[model samples]
Target: MMINSTQVSYFTLSAYFDTGLFKYLCFMIVMSLYVLIVGSNLLLVVVICMNRSLHEPMYLFLCSLFVNELVGSSGLFPFLLVQILSDSHTVSAPLCFLQIFCVHYYGAVEYLNLAVMSYDRYLAICYPLQYNTRMTYNKIATLIALTWLCPCCAMVVLMSLTSSLQLCRNTIYKVYCDTHSVVKLSCSDINVINVYGLIATFSTIFGSLLLILFSYVRILRVCFSGSKQTRQKAVSTCTPHLASLLNFSVGACFEVSQSRFNMSTLPNVLRIFLSLYFLTCPPLFNPVLYGLNLSKIRVIFKSLISNAA
Candidate 1:
C-alpha cells in the first residue's frame, strides 16, 4: 500500500452503533464487563493479600497474575468503555500515543509475568528439592522485578520506533490503539520497518509461548513418573495453568492472524474480534484461572462474606 503524506490524520470511527437501541445495549454490556473484570481481579488480589496461607510462592504468583490483569484491563478497557457509551469515537494524536503506550506496556508486562510463572512452576515440579532454596521469597521478588523490567525494555524499542513515524493524518479503525493501526497511518514508506517490527513482536510472543509449553511438558513428564497421589495433585494444580495457557494460545493465534492478513481483505468486524480476543479476553480470564480454583481462595472468600455480614 502506498502512503499519502498529505492525509496527515484521519479522525473517523465506523458507524458501529447506528441504531440507538443497539448503542445503548452495547454500552450497557461493555460497562457490565468492565465492572466484572475490574471487580473480580481486585477481589482476587485482596484475597491473596489478606490470607496468610496464600502468602506462599504459588499464591504470590497468583497475586502477580491478578496484578497483571488489573494493569492490562485498566490500560485498555476504560477508554473503550467510554467509546461504547458515547456517539463520538474520535481520538487525538497525543492521546493516541498514550493509548498505544499503555496497551503495549501492560501487554508486554503480562507476557513476561506469565513466562516467569512458567519458570516458577518448572522449578517447583521438576526440581522439588531445590525449589524452596532456589525460589526463596527474595528470589521470587527479584523475578517479579525482572518481569517488570523486561516490559520497560520492549516499550523503549516499540515506542521509539512508532513515535518516529509520520502518521499522515489517518486515524485508526479499531476501538483501541494498536501497533498495526498506528503503523498503517504513517505517510512514509514504512513497509520494511513495519515488517521488521511485526516480526520482532511475533518472535517475542511466540518464543515465550514456546518456553511455557516446554516447561509444562517437562512438568507433566516429571509428575507422571511419581506416585498416584503426587500425580493427581500435580494434575489438579496444572489444570488451571493449562486453562490459562489455552486461552493465551487462542488469543495469540487470533492476534497473529489479524496482523498477517491484509487489512482490506479482512472485514472490520473480524479485525475487531481478533483484537478483543487477544487484548480483552485473556486479561479477564487470568484471575479466574489462578484464584477461583484454589481451596484457600474458597475459604477466604467465604470468610470475607461472613465478616461482611
Candidate 2:
C-alpha cells in the first residue's frame, strides 16, 4: 500500500487509552505516580550535588543515574498525564519521535551507568590502594559524559533513519513511541533501520551486562578472600547497587519484550501496565532503595528530614 509520508503528520496513542470507566481514577493515580517519580529522583540528585561527601566516583554515578531517571520520566509522565486527561491521545510526529529518542537514550545510558557504577565499586572494594588514583574526578567525568553521549548519538542516528521512512500507520499501540514501534509502522523497506536498531540494542544491552558481571565477579572474589570488616563493608556497598540493577533490569526486560513479542493475548490493562513499568517503577524505587541502604546517605537524608520538621 503506497502512502504519503506527509499525511502522517501525527500519531494516535490507541492501546493505552483503555482505562474504561475509571478514567478519572486513572488520572489521579498517574498524576500521583508522576509526582513521586519526579520528587524522589530530583531529591537524590539535589542531595548528591549539594553534599561534598558524595562527590566520590560511586555517588557521582548514582547522581547521573538519578538525573537519567528524571530525564526518562520527563519523556513520558508529563505527556502521559496530559493524555489521560485528554479525549484524544494524538501526538505530533516530531514530538513522537522526540519522545522515542528520549526513551531509548535513557535506557541505553541507564545500563551503561550501572555498569560503570559496578566497576567503580569493584575498584574501591578490590583495589583499595589504587582506587583513588584510577577513579579520579577526570575519569568519573569522562565516564559520565560517555554514558550520556553515546546513547544520545545513537538515538539521533536511529531517529534520523526513522524520520525518512514512509509510514503507513498513524496509530501506535504502546504507551509511548519507541524505535521498534515507529520503524515497524514504515510502509516500505525497513531493513536498514531494523538491522541498525538490532545492532544498537544488542551492543548496548549485552555489552553493559557483561561488564557489570565481570565487575561483580572480581568484587565477589575479593570479598570472599577478605577479612570480616572488609566483607561487611563490601556487602554494605554492593547490596544497594545490585538491588537497583535488578530493579532496572526487570523493567528494561519488560520494555524490550513488549516491543519484540506479539503480546496480543494479554489484556489491555496488563499490557498497558507492563509497557509503562520501565518509565515509572525504576525512577521511583532506585532513590528510595539506595537512600535506605547506603549508611551515609541514610544519615544525611535523616538529618534533612529532621531539620525540615
Which lDDT tens digits does candidate 2 get at residues 1-309?
345777998888888655676888988998898899889889888999999998888888999999999999999988887887778888999899889888888899999999999899989998999999999999999999999999888988888899999888887887778778877788889999889998998999899999999999998898888999889988888898888888888888888889889999998889888888877888988998888888889999989989999
Show model 1 residue runs off by greater than 4 Å: 1-10, 15-17, 189-192, 195-199, 263-270
Residue-level lDDT tens digits of model 1 in 10-56: 34445244556676787787778778888998988888888788888
Q: What are the lDDT figures for the candidates, one per model? A: 0.74, 0.87
| Candidate 2 CA-lDDT value | 0.87
Best by TM-score: 2
Error of 2 at 67 (Å): 0.2
